[model samples]
Target: MRIVVAHNRYREAQPSGENTIVDAEMAQLTAAGVEVLPFIRSSDEIPTMPTTAKALLPISPIYAPRAQQELSRLLTEHRPDVLHLHNPYPLLSPWVVRTAHRHGVPVVQTVHNYRQVCSSGLYFRDGMICQDCRGRALGVPAIVHRCYRGSRAQSALMATTLAVHRGTWKSVDRFIALTTAVADHLRDYGIPDERIVVKPNAVPDPGPPAPLGDGFLFMGRLTPEKGLDLLLEAWRRHPVGALGPLRVAGDGELRPMVEAAAAERPDVSYLGQLDRAGVRAAIEASAVVLATSTWHDVLPTVIIEALASGRPVLGTALGGIPYLVGAGTPREPAGTGPASVASAVRGDGAATLPVGVVAGEAGWVVSPDPAALAAALPVARTGAAALAPAARARYERTFHPDVVTKQLIDIYADAARTAPRH
Candidate 1:
């Protein structure tokens, strides 16, 4: 099958998991013998654009005439069977859906976030989960609160673009929801069950996973929503050197908090921002990986990375973390001692959620709190060895390119059947 994949990449300095996933998926398709065409744009180009292009940048979110013209030429020349879209923001607008429809091409979009209704696409603002603009036609609340990149003007533009493209998004032939939580979000947005498919992103298999490592690694942006503070508070509850070591990475608004924690505790160390190789090295050296986001994070790639490397994840029970960690599956544990599913018991003797360090299980999914995470830490450390195989097994079954790419190909075939027969 011939497929055209389009995406507007986020800036490189910050890095975007979506960009990484898109590239990985395209490579997976090519390896599987499918013809793939990538149409991509980068936010890094905004700084050195020609005067004419820069002049049209402000309105590009609503309708990028240049993108439409270029896409039209590509589609008309190729006549591809399907058009799959990832992120379409400042340069590649949602109008690309209309362009695909005009060319009689079925459009399949991977819904990455809550952008359809919320201007920020995060449903979070000012360090809190805010959905004030959910039912509004214009999302005036977003503009008032300066939610999009802390600029009222930019928020207004994004909000207006969302309001105008309501039909364009809904009219998509298929929506690839990254997680069950994302699928639920699409349903709440009025997408029918048949039009939405649950397809998680896949990572490359890193060959045989090394033996379980020591300590725990928390990588990603050190922001309020990423829950770096909560992790630290829990770490402080334990005495120094009591629960192995904790390594924190990434830079964000909460860097001071992370640095302070590292300075105050010998067990805690800050590794700053990591390149892909550095991240892999850290994962290999860690017994468990952390995904402690306070917001409704759709999917944190770090959890999957740890799984692929045979490291169990200690994730918060929010958004797709539970699903990513293989929770709610009706499979029995592997063996005795750390192999059984563990319930995080509070210091006060209260029990919280369970950690599945079992046969098909990945790890623990605790409540989004310091206490729950604190209770789960020792359990995760104890079960790291038994959980290592389970983590690797889960990666091979679900997030491996050998598995998810076939599901994607089937989705493309279904989408192609829905294209207009003009």
Candidate 2:
């Protein structure tokens, strides 16, 4: 039951669902009587790193010798049964996987995004979904486009890191995919079907559904990829009218746009980024949650959090979203059927499907187009109250922390069995 939980925290400037998931899982495991040995690195520390350490950041992704040495020491000291890795970019490298394996500790990594194939890890570019580097041996598209942080050098470095350590990723005893789509993406990258497991991230339940408050809730990083613009356009086309105001939480590159829209329209209010409790309160108060991301998001936790709070989501039918919102059933492993083949041929870009409006529960799934989003907005206004119970039901059945934690325990046990006997 003892494990080393390793993760590299993303920069604190932007809210990170991956970071949220890691913290929640660690807390849940400890509460469940499992011992967690944390091995963590923070992007916040990068700016404060000494001059020599700053120089080391470039090689950190490729192979951080010091990180490997420290991890080796941790393995020798703790003798953990399993090493569970979340994000291993910039600070901790794939060397940790090799280090864990060398020390007889099985490694279990969570595939949080499309980082294995796309340099930005977002599978996005130029305000649109892009997947030009998939299955490519060299990842030249990322280099050509400067996808990561808009720096060719950084993007090239990430691409090189992926190329150099493709085998190191395969060395993992298990890959925890956040959704069926994520598992399918991993398989598309040549990971074996048996090695990948579908495990969606779950949030701590926010008790019972609060009384329905007002219009809708759109929360998360307010970036282009999040499709905030699309949401605004949809709102412009179809004003909130009788339902109530549309509340937007979080800040990013699109703050001015949000602020301008809020000023121009009384129905749209931009509430700056809210903390965890704030987000929950908003979810509880809102009639529906909005997830308008244009990219193939692995599994936006906001959708699940809303469902957990008994608020249905009106989200894009992209990536793992349709599955997350219960608009569609879980996809089978890749290549299992004709649909799988079609999905593969479609690449990793966000494919807009027809509007799905579920009755009584769940929510609507629409294309990112403003017209499509405009068409689905009323579904939330009309059906969200009735769908509250079903939203909570979905959370309990699939994303309850108790349920997901047990699954984690089983995965850890399976991974531990793969480790060499002491």
For candidate 1, which ten residues in a row score worst on lDDT?
351-360
Model 2, which residues run further than 4 Å from truth?
A: 329-361, 419-422
Candidate 1 lDDT (Cα, 0 to 1): 0.85
What is candidate 2's local distance difference test score?
Answer: 0.83
- Model 1 scores a TM of 0.92
Candidate 1: deviation at residue 149, Å?
Answer: 0.8
Tens digit of per-residue lDDT, candidate 1, span 1-422: 99999999998877578888999999999999999989999999999999999999989999999999999999999999999999999899999999988999999999888999998888888777888997788999999999888999999999999999999988999999999999999998889999999999999888898777798999997778888877888788888998898999888778898888888989999998888899898999899999888888999988889999999998777788889988742222455232334643432343343433221278877666566577668877887887798899999999999899999999999989864543
lDDT of 2 by residue, 51-73 (tens): 99899899899898878898999
lDDT at 130, model 1: 87
Error of 1 at 5 (Å): 1.0
Clash number by candidate, in order: 0, 0
The candidate that achieves the highest lDDT relative to the unseen native structure: 1
* Model 2, C-alpha of 319: deviation from truth (Å): 1.1
lDDT by candidate, in order shown: 0.85, 0.83
Deviation from native of the Cα of residue 181 in model 1, angstroms:
0.9
